[model samples]
Target: MSGPVWAPPEPGAVDVHTHVVPPATSFVERLTATDPRWARLVRRADRDDVADVVVAGRLFRTVRRVAYDLDQRHAEQAARGLAGQVLSAMPELFATWAPAAEAADYCRAFNEWLAEQVVGYDGFYCGLGIVPLQDPAVAPELLAEIGRLGLLGVEIPCATPDAPLHDRRFDEFFTEAERLGLLVFMHSVGSVTEFDHAMAGTGAIFPARIGEALAGLIANGVLARHPGLRLLASHGGGGLPASVARLDFVRGMAPPTRESMPEPAATYARRIWFDPLVFDAAVLCLLIELVGTDRLVLGSDYPFLPVDPAELLRDPRLPDGLVDQVRSENPRRLLADAPGTKHEE
Candidate 1:
């Protein structure tokens, strides 16, 4: 392997990749203005036809969902599957969280509701709170309070094309996040400037656009600036692991070194972590090789991705020890290693 080989996690270890939809966030209530199909579902939580997904293939019921509300889902997860998931966030972050200007109250109410769940629940759940990136200025305090509440982290949307991850002003968010040892999760969203517009027509551009944005986060200095911040990219970190050879000018050479950036191939591969929900082993192997198994963590993209977390966690191709590491150890270390977790050096 190009990087140090890591061990799989022990039973009950930390799972940093699973995504969840806490009841308090009322994620089911918010819909993006761009996707009206989603709007109807928010209004009707348990829709038979309302099975819109927050992640790729996972669907939401008209009934509100709990981490393990579905016995089939739990049976799949309980085999010591992906440690935990980042749940669906409160809907307000999206442009369609509300029909109009009454959104502020909805936002406040949802945050309080989320707090109620995180504070009340135990073992089976962990919280990744939400913040409205539209008002980036207030994000730090939001993150700080979430941390104080002992939530796992905060979830923010992918950077809009108009607002790339490299914007240093957003550093305040990362800065406070770093101070509180909060994790910043980047999931997909809309911007006046989209990284990709499926609405424009056709193409699997989401993966490609994600690659550009995330690579910018690191190669462009976002990671370097907020050294203490911890971030997890959704959807296989979009496609960074797969794009390396292109960066190296190898098999599928890249377009033309967009910026004077480092051969992001090895750099990104080694730094950013990804979830195990990737449906292929060859890609999983390559990610392990490029990013090193240690940086790679187990992610189920649960309540979203259709695959069972256990099966993905135990990918046959991934070495056994490495699978253990991804399941829990790495996440435990990531969070416990954070300055405030009270872990010893």
Candidate 2:
């Protein structure tokens, strides 16, 4: 948060958090008859640009063209002075609750389609793939496929259907992710069903789940075990920054926690990246203080909550050069290692 004013780079800021949904024609009929969790888009008769995402015969949520139309997404990014976006599958499509093989097949189709979608956008967009974490045994193969497809990395939910991220089952997957230099974007599905029961709500639960995932990684030594892993916590680390002191406090009193953890929870927290989507300048500043500027990236969660880079610059409490770092430089560093992706020098 403290540094000399940075000379503004060129106009293209990189948004690390955005999502895209594939057209229903791609998979709806193919999977709907057999797959209970298949999500299909139903166009709204009243509006041309919007549609409702339906799953299991239930209304999921509504989305606009920006969620799937690359042309419109590119235009919007240009309007906001952004040069690029890192797109991931909508968490709803994750379908982690399904059987492992079923989930893997669905993920494979989506990953290939998303990777192909990035080709037209080229330098303006990179894509993140998903793996079937329900069966950790299959994760490494899927991750390898993701790498083969030239994806920047994979989007991971806060927890599997029955296991937290820290469970031993995921150690191999994490190991492979580190070896591949893939970015692990840990985003909660915004469902209380994916996290601990105590952390529940419509508005507050999303961040709470993300915080829990971050804490679990640190406390369970996932970060320490795989130091080379590129991890990005969404929603500004989703309460981790605000609650780090409590994590440290607990570690001090619990001898077992200190013995098991390789370093202070806050120390591990700083080593990872976070998206600056806290929605409050003061909170963003605090996250900067906790994680340092190099680890904070711009994440608009585009289409759901499109953010303008100027919104970050408008805040006086933040340092003068932070916009360039969070919106441009840091994100480039995050995606630089991926094949088929572009980055500024």
Alpha-carbon lDDT, every model: 0.53, 0.78
Candidate 1 on 200-319: residue-level lDDT in tens? 311255456666767667555566566556777655665776566655564234444434344444764465656654567776776677777787665665544456555665767777
For model 1, what is the C-alpha lDDT against the true structure?
0.53
Flag regions of model 1 displaced more than 4 Å.
1-10, 22-64, 67-93, 96-108, 190-205, 242-265, 312-316, 338-345
Against the hidden reference, what TM-scores do the models get? 0.69, 0.89
**Cα lDDT tens digits for candidate 2, 129-199:** 99999989998888878887878789999887689999989999999998887888898765544434413
Best by TM-score: 2
Indicate which candidate wins on lDDT: 2
True-vs-predicted CA distance for residue 137, candidate 2, Å = 0.5
